[model samples]
Target: MAMLTIKDLNVYYGVIQAIKGISFEVNEGEVIALIGANGAGKTTILHTITGLITPKAGSIDFEGNDLVKIPAHKIVSLGMAHVPEGRRIFAELTVLENLKMGAYTRSDKKEMENTLEMIYKRFPRLKERKNQIAGTLSGGEQQMLAMGRALMSHPRIILMDEPSMGLSPLFVSEIFDIIREISESGTTVLLVEQNAKKALSIADRAYVLETGNIVLSGDAKELMNDDSVKKAYLGE
Candidate 1:
């Protein structure tokens, strides 16, 4: 069933429309990707869904709740986690401290510890440097910390923006592997990435955006094989 649904989404910055009547759905346990070049408004869709940006017109439904009416902080408590484009962990905070902040919606100490343990098992480097300052970590490690922090929310669905950006090839590969593992373990993902190839590889379905509109969408593998998708996004 659809865990998240966006219908006729129209968003704008002042008078400039950033997303124009786009619609999509993410089913439970599915990894859905939105791929486009920079300025394509892919991130805008995520921001709108996560309640960081209110739409000029649209309806965002998360498990029957109207996301547009909900506050951003309350959205996190509703089992939605966003790992933003910049890995926006608190720079001065310790790694553990940043992670603890993600669980602010929760009150159960024992459950929190269990979640922390799961996060550490998934990102062992984080466990190794739990007390280290977040800003001191390498780019890839910072990315890991950001993801770990999101997982600490125990979300049913995750919205990831530019997850593989600014990483070495090896680290990118590692990050993608973990993303697939996360999906396999049953957390639905809505990924926005300029790296179309990587995004489509792990996604069950994909939407192609261009200049504030969804130009195409379908099963991930079919889009990967499409001539236009190959030429425009796959660099073939």
Candidate 2:
């Protein structure tokens, strides 16, 4: 079933329209990608879904609740986690502290510790540097920390924005592998990525956006082989 559904989303910034009546749904245990260029309003869509940016018009339903009506913090407790662009970890905090912040909505300390241990297992580097200051980590390490932190929330669905941005080729490959692992571990994913090739490679379904509109959408492999996608996004 649909874990998250966005219908007729319209978002505006001042007098400029950012997202224009776009809609998409992410079902349980599926990886859905929103691939587009920088100005295609991809990030805006993720922000809107997570309740960070309110749409001028639309309905965002996560499970059964209208996300548009829910407060951002409350939304997190509703089983949605967002790993925003730029690896926005608290610069001064330790890796453990940053991860702890992600579980702020939860009250079960023992459960939180169990989740933290699970995260440490997935990101061994994080476990090794659990006490290291977050700001001191390398770019790739910071990205890992961000993902680990988001997982700490025990989300039913995770929204990842540009998880591979600015990484070295090896790190990029590693990050994409981890994304697939996350999906396989049974967490639904809505990924906003400019790395169309990598995004489509792992997505079960994908939507192509341009200037705030969804221009094409279908099975990920089919879109990967589409001529237009090759020329415009795959750099074929």
Candidate 3:
């Protein structure tokens, strides 16, 4: 069964239709990339799936439950974690405190601590700066912290939006590597990225979105080698 599924989703911002009817699925342990240019409605798809925005029509099912009918906070408790765009960490909180906040839905202290240790193991920089204020960290460090915080929820599926935005090339590589690691460790990933090259490189499958619609989708490697994708997205 697919880990998450969306069927004929439609969303709007008042009178402006931000996402036309679109559908996709993320299977268990797969890294599915939704690659699109700015304003292509990739993020809107994610927001609707995570309940930040209600879809005008369609069904978003995660593990047999309709996400559209559920509340946002309840979605996370259902083992779905969203690492939103811009690394929305609490600026004033310490790194460790921010991580703790990610696990607020849980009450098992021992399990939360174990999850924290796992996060530290994955991003050692977060462990080093555990006591430092979140806003004071460098861009790469902050991104890692954001990812680490998301993993603290022990989610079965992780939704990441523009994780490589505003980072050096080295950090972009690092973040993508970590994304692969996250998937290999049994978490299904639904990634929305502007960097088509990097996104396609690691994705099991990819969808191309243009102006609020999915224009194409196929094996990531096949999309990478396509003439149109090379011309428009890869700068080939």
Please give, for residues 142-207, the per-residue lDDT of candidate 1 as tens digits: 999999999999999999999999999999999999999999988999999999999999999999
Off by over 4 Å in 1: none
Global lDDT of each candidate: 0.94, 0.94, 0.93
Residue 177 C-alpha lDDT in model 2: 95
C-alpha RMSD in Å of predicted model 1 compared with the true structure: 0.7
Clashing pairs in 2: none
Q: Which window of 10 residues has the lowest lDDT sum in candidate 3?
A: 1-10
Q: Locate the minimum summed-lDDT window of 10 residues in model 1.
A: 1-10
As a TM-score, model 3 comes out at: 0.98
lDDT of 3 at 81: 93
Rank the models by lDDT, top first. Answer: 1, 2, 3
Q: Cα deviation in Å at residue 169, candidate 1?
A: 0.4
Q: Which tens-of-lDDT digit does each residue in 73-153 have in candidate 2?
A: 788889999999999999899999999999988899999999998998889999999999999999999999999989999
